[model samples]
Target: MKPSLLILIHLNDASRASIEAAFDVVYAPDSTRRSAAIAARGDTIRAVLTNGTTGLTAAEIDRMPQLELISALGAGYENLAVDHARSRGIVLVNGAGTNDHCVADHAFALLLAIVRDVPQLDRATRDGIWRDTLPMQPNVSGKRLGIVGLGNIGEKVARRGAGFDMDIAYHNRKPREGSALRYFDSVVALARWSDFLVVATPGGAGTHHLIGKPVFEALGPNGFVVNVSRGSVLDTAALAQALVTQTIAGAALDVYESEPHPPEALLTLRNVVLTPHVGGRSPEAITASVDNFLANATRHFAGKAVLTPI
Candidate 1:
């Protein structure tokens, strides 16, 4: 018999249909359904599919005594109970490189949108306000761009920055080997040197609130910041305060601390731009991610090693 799979995140009809061809799927994309499905089918579920944000907990794993595999749909598995899953010998995998370019594209889009004041300008134009009445925006090209966590997505962001003729630097736990790009030992130092700061770090306790008052203060009044990583990486309260006091010129984010619900603190700020954590979402990216997941699952079920193990 095909192994029963429990999916904790939303999947489009096509993606769901594809997965159904290979396994008996128990679809539960929300809290109510998740609880009900787990209670009813936990004994038979042999695999679980989730994203970083909608992670499977240790308690949930305990409920599913037969679960042997856990797959995160994206690069992040911050909320997954990785340690507990590992102890249970559950095979863990993620869609690491599948959405890197899409996220990088969205990060650059946010940078341009905030720096050029695009949203505000469009609104003003709609109100019949002309260019002469508005403040001039700064040029995005030929400025220093700082990146935090020089991973796959960060590398893509750097490539895009190069196209704009922007000088780029990055801060990581250690400098990436064979990379000629300038590296800073500290995030504060990088922020101090950059006109634009883009955060692409991982989430979880170690990186929670990594961007706060000190980093914002270092970014100064003329700087702009963008985040395409997990929301926990940037403190929303600190960000709102920075925007309100103009600690930094402006900020843009695809992720935030309060998710699903809009951040109430930043709602009134004109200097901030927000998107609902869609940095890695695109038709191309989604297809690649689903394909990767299917490949890994197929290999695992055939008694072969899985790809992209976390």
Candidate 2:
């Protein structure tokens, strides 16, 4: 008999079909359905699929006594009950390299959109305003780019920055080994040195609000910031305050604390650009992630080690 799989995140029809071909699938993409599915089918499930934000909690893991595998469809597994799962001897895997390029591309898109004031300029042009009447925007090229994480996504962001002739640096708990890019021991120092700061770090308590008022202040009135990482990594209240007081030139984000609900405080701010947490989403990226999950799952059920263990 095929192992039963419980999927806690939304998937496209094709992706669903692909997974269904291998397992007895239970689809629950929202809170109500998730609770119901777990309560009803928890005993039958052998594997679970989720993303970082819609993580499977320790309590939920405990409910699934038969669950031997859990997989995240993206690089982050911050919300997953990793230690609890490990204690239970459940296998953990994530799609780390699958969506890095897509996220890096979106980070730059947000950076350029905010830095160049693209959305505002487009609106002005539609209303018959000319460039001569507007304030000049700064060039994205030839600037100092600071990355908050130097993982797969950060490395890709750095590579993109290089294409724009930007001098690049990064901040991690410690400097990444063999990296020639300049490293800052602290986020504040990196912000002070950066013309554009892009946050691609992981989430969880260790990094909660890692970027806040102090980092914004250090970034000064001329620097722009972009966040493609988890929302909790940047403080929304602080970002709104910074924009209101012109503490920073502008900001762009694909993720924010409010999530499914738009951040109310930043709604009226023209100095910021927002996307609905889609930095790592693309047809290509989704396909790759799904394929990676299937590969890992297939291997795990066949009594082999899974790829990309978290």
Model 1 earns a TM-score of: 0.99
TM-score of each: 0.99, 0.99
Error of 2 at 81 (Å): 0.7
User: 126-175, model 2: which lDDT tens digit per residue?
Assistant: 99999899999999999999999999999999999999999999999999
Candidate 1 residue-wise lDDT at 251: 94
- Tell how far residue 168 is off in model 2, in angstroms: 0.6
TM-score of candidate 2 to 2 decimals: 0.99
**C-alpha lDDT of residue 217 in model 2:** 99
Report the Cα lDDT for residue 51, model 1.
97
Name the 10 consecutive residues with the lowest summed lDDT in model 2.
Answer: 254-263
List where candidate 1 sits over 4 angstroms from the true fold: none
